[model samples]
Target: MNRLNEQFEKYLLDNLPKSKSFHPHFEKALQQMLVAGGKRFRPLLVLSVTDALQPLLLRNALPVAYAIELLHTYSLIHDDLPVFDNADLRRGMPTLHKTYDEVTAILVGDALNTHAFFLLADAPLPADTKVEIVKELAREGGIEGMIIGQAIDCWFEKKKLALDELKFLHIHKTAKLIAASLKIGAIICNEKEIAKKLYDFGIDLGLLFQIQDDLIDALQDDTKAGKTTSNDENKNSFVNLLGIDGAMKSADELVEKLETGLEAFDTKLKNNLKKILNNYLYRHKNL
Candidate 1:
């Protein structure tokens, strides 16, 4: 995974979006969140799955991985906008809006969002495979997925949603994209038998990720979390809906479920998935 992260980072640097604009910082802002760094969770999922099933295709899969990162980073930029989370920090650095300006931040997010698909369109993969990758990305990260969840989240601030409703929000906002990452990798590798199963696992894994993030937001300060903390006080978060204790229990249950599910996968795929998830699978429990 370390090797993969290094390779992906190199790819990101090599393929950064280029522009020469009158504005001084447009291009820089567009690449800021991505280069500043985060967990790289979604892209790693794509790479890990690809590596496990078809090692020879790992290099070709980098573009798909990068596209997911671009899309994910765009979401973070928009999520930090004044009208949204209004967060000043992300990935351990000042958010684009804070470092530059709100307008710059907004436009950067839009550019990154559009460029995600552009990367897919320009990848070296075959036409049909690229189309399938595009479909998964669009379905999971588009209006039916993250956008609607973001809409619900912004609209329902300070209002308590039902437990199921909260799950729906996070599933759409977080899980769908993560699931799409895995499924897209399977599509890239022609592993149809395993794609749906990996996607299902990704949904639960993404929920677990959100739950853990909520726990971190509750317990860790900005310096520790590398982002704004205690920011979900008014939003529907796992730690808010379920107190810290209840949220911990929920995480525990998910950890057990995911571990059990891991056992069902073929040994090689299971090992590969486990390598990527070793410390992360139960991160909240340590808190």
Candidate 2:
């Protein structure tokens, strides 16, 4: 896992947009956000799917993986803006808006968002395949998906959200992009059935992740989590909607469901995915 993360980081640096000398500050902001240490979970999903189906295609899948990371980074930048979450920290450092100006932060996010598509457009895949990949990403990351989820979250802040409503919010906001990562990788290999299965798996995995995040926020302080904690105090989170005990119960159920979903996969793939799920469980044992 460490080696895979190292390789992905190198590839990301190599493919990152070059900074113009005249616009050094603008480029610096973008670079800083990208370099801010993250788990690179989304890209790993893309690579893992490809590795399971066709390791030979991993080289060709690099661009797609990078594009997903770029898109995820853009969303983080925007999510931290003053008008949004007004977050001060991300990836254990000052957020883009806090490090730079609001305008710069916004443009950096815009650049990264559009540049993600640029990477996809320039990938070695066939035109039809590229189109499918682009359509999936755009729909998942756009209004029909993440945007709507964010809108609902902000629109209903400070209000109690029912369990189903909270699930709907997260399914679009967090799970869609995650599901896209897996689906895009399967699409790269032309495995439609596998893509759908991975999508289903990703949805459960994403929800589990979000629930764990809420638990962390409620239990840990900012120093422990490496970012602003308690930020969800006013937001509709699983920890808020469901009591901590209830959220923990939900997470256990999700883990069982996710494990069962992998039964149809080959042993190697199932083991690889189970490793990831177990890592998540280990990290949030308090839950």
Name the candidate that leads on TM-score.
Answer: 1
The CA lDDT at 77 in model 1 is 92
* TM-score, cand. 2: 0.96
- Distance (Å) between predicted and true CA of 93, model 2? 0.9
lDDT of 2: 0.87
- Could you give candidate 2's per-residue lDDT for residues 34-117 as a string of tens digits? 787688888988887787787788888999999999999999999989998998988888988888889999999999999999
What's the residue-level lDDT of 272 in candidate 2? 59
Model 1 TM-score, 2 decimals: 0.98
What stretches of model 2 exceed 4 Å from their correct place? none
